[model samples]
Target: MTDALDRIRSIALLLPEVEERVSHGQPTFFVAGKQFAQFRDDHHGDGRVAVCVRTSGMDEQAMLLDAAPDTYSRPAYLGPSGWVAVNVAADDVDWALVEDRVARSWELAAPARLLEAGGR
Candidate 1:
């Protein structure tokens, strides 16, 4: 695994019921069998290492992309579904922000009981 993938795995696995599996040639994180996060490496020649996660909605996706175009983007194949991508390979990447987003994604996909347990 690359450093970016390692970092994502470390943070993503901390959430309750989070599982890592390879999906579409990328490392994907699932909560209660629902995909919450996916680490993409040069996806279809995009030349980026990113973690795609679920956003609250299209508004959130637009807000994030507008706020930080360098760090956030509309992920391919999943963008229409309200998933946004964070550029994890950028030199100015903010890992804390990534963690926060990943946690939110986990909460979005996790079951009600798992979420009620604090999702830690």
Candidate 2:
């Protein structure tokens, strides 16, 4: 993987049965029919790629907001219920974290059926 798309694609590779597609005007990767992560470029003109992680509503907002206000933002309009957006700015973000989140997203979205089927 080269950029955010590549990074996300890499993470998707860890799961058994998952698919990638464009949805809601962005590149979205899904597992077992549920969306785990979505990739977004800062703007059509810019080259920065942003990755959004869907967290449990239980996620602590105050700290997340304080730590990296710029890289971390609301998960789109849905930032309210528990989704946090983390910048995967290709050049700066720690890819390992992104990879980990992607892995978790797959686990979160992948249904039990797919998990049991198990295959590359």
Candidate 3:
């Protein structure tokens, strides 16, 4: 569990101008002061450890949730805003998928200049 969290942190921080901070008692990744992703550990006693990130839009969110119920879900509070949660604690954790989600979230929150720089 700790390993997974560490891996998430590493991937999120590697994004351009990303910073990690504690918000609502959870580790949140921000780009240009806007939140993109958050690490939730048993959030609100739900007993699920996952990374919640912003999606391209509601359609993307619905597609992911329908495609992988076990791996993805609509996070509370943020779901209506097109945010999706990826279950990091699943038995078959897909780090590549996680990285992609983080990257997309970063791109969504990043400034135009950062995105124009290729977001490397």
In angstroms, give how far residue 120 of model 2 lies from its true place: 11
Looking at candidate 3, the ten consecutive residues that score lowest on lDDT are 111-120
lDDT digits (tens) for residues 1-120 of candidate 3: 788789999999888888899998989999999999999988888888999999999999999999999999888788999999999997889899999989989998899999898886
**Candidate 1 local accuracy as lDDT?**
0.91
Which ranges in model 2 have alpha carbons more than 4 Å from their true place? 43-48, 58-63, 114-120
- State the lDDT at 75 in candidate 3: 87
Clash count list over all predictions:
0, 0, 0
Clashing pairs in 2: none
Q: Ten-residue segment with the worst summed lDDT in candidate 1?
A: 111-120
lDDT tens per residue, model 1, 1-120: 299999999999988878899999889999889999999998999987899999999999999999999999899998999999999998878889999999999888889998677666
- lDDT scores of the candidates, listed in order: 0.91, 0.69, 0.92
Reference-based TM-score of each model: 0.96, 0.75, 0.96
Give the clash total for candidate 3: 0
